[model samples]
Target: MDLDTGVALSRHDDHVDPFPVRRAEPAHAVPAGRMGYDLGAERLLLHTVQSAEAFESLLTTGTLRPDPELAEEAFTDAYEWIHRMMAARLPTRGEGALWFWARTRRKHLVDTCRRSRGRVLLTCRVPRERVLLSHFDEWHLVLNKGLGMPRLPGESEDDAFARWEEEHDDFDARLRAAGMRDAPVRDWPADLRTEIEKSWESIFDRGNYGPFECWQGTTHALNNDEVLEAVRII
Candidate 1:
């Protein structure tokens, strides 16, 4: 595949040290989104509802409310969990774009949640221009820091790098066959890196998105027990 991948990933020895510890300085700004799951910071939870009535009930109880502008859109009776992902590596726009994207996700997330009417988990794998999920399905997939390709399964890190370095002959051919795209890329800000990694949390932090916010004044617990998470048998 003649594809340019997203962000430079950090690859440690997947078997020996899958989760290495590195301390990042606190975010320079007051943190616009959730930190990465690897960090101990809180994760945002949401109570997805299907109608204005259900949504308004939560508001009355001071639980949750849809963004007024966003809520103007009609919702349906379908109920499902939509696992949507957002990427916010806005190098050109800087912090302003981060806040803008975060807030946008907050509104759009409810729209996705509202259309879910089954036991399906609707997931959107996003634009490749930004650094996408790392260690998503398996930790074994390591980006050869030097070569930037997935290390072959069971290959030692050294061997992977060696193979990756020597394989430029048919690299682009293989990448295109694997459905990769040729795209320009840039690095994310160190401070916003964690937030983008867990950008899903931003959907519940509507208050941080804009001055005219509608989230109830509460930090929701990190589970579905208190949430209106819906499911249906297939």
Candidate 2:
């Protein structure tokens, strides 16, 4: 299983649908990677490992594991015992300390991560005790094939890095071809609405719009075009 590196739909594409919409046979999706930074505990955890298998774990289950880095398991028991063990190592930050600057930052990160669901990976870990304010302030992450470089199953570190560079450049070319342009974001006008309705029926053979949110976002400078119907997103 390589990965699903499909080109996500963007808001700015001039044409959102193909001239002649035809349903094609399903095919194996390419593998893709997502990387980001995380403010964990009192340290900054930089996103480093993102394998197809790890991503699969996230896709299947919401929680991340230590080995495959992702897995499916019900927390019905709330993992009460394990929680206690961790609490022993790092006592829960009491309410009084909630007013502390560190706690405030931690809450921001936890809340945002929850809102983004499980698609995010925060790997860059830097301790607040050592990192300069400027570097810490520059913290950011993006989920796209062109962003992070994770070592493949058997590839060398250098080889994986090179592969990522090539992938990023290729992705840029596609965006450039689309003129890095997209349509304005607004309520779906009648014509666009009709196309979207068709998308629901044709794209997934379903009735309601399942991918509504996926195709929506503020238009920005990004390569996006519906003309390229043969786009093979990983």
Error of 1 at 71 (Å): 31
Residue 124 C-alpha lDDT in model 1: 15
Report model 2's TM-score to 2 decimal places. 0.20
Model 1 agreement with the true structure over 38-59: per-residue lDDT tens digits: 1111322222223434333442
Compute each candidate's TM-score over C-alphas: 0.19, 0.20
User: Model 2, range 1-234, lDDT digits (tens) per residue?
Assistant: 113433334323463322111221222121133222332346533222133444444334533234411222332111222222223433232111000111123334334334433232222233433221211111111111123333456677689668867866764565456454132212324444233223222211112122121111011011112112222212
Residue 143 CA displacement from its true place in model 1, Å: 13
Name the candidate that leads on TM-score: 2
After superposition, which runs of candidate 1 have C-alpha atoms over 4 Å from their true positions?
1-132, 135-148, 172-234
For candidate 1, the 10 contiguous residues with the lowest summed lDDT are 74-83
Q: Please list the residue runs of candidate 2 whose C-alpha ends up more than 4 Å from where it truly belongs after superposition.
A: 1-145, 181-234
lDDT of 1 at 135: 25
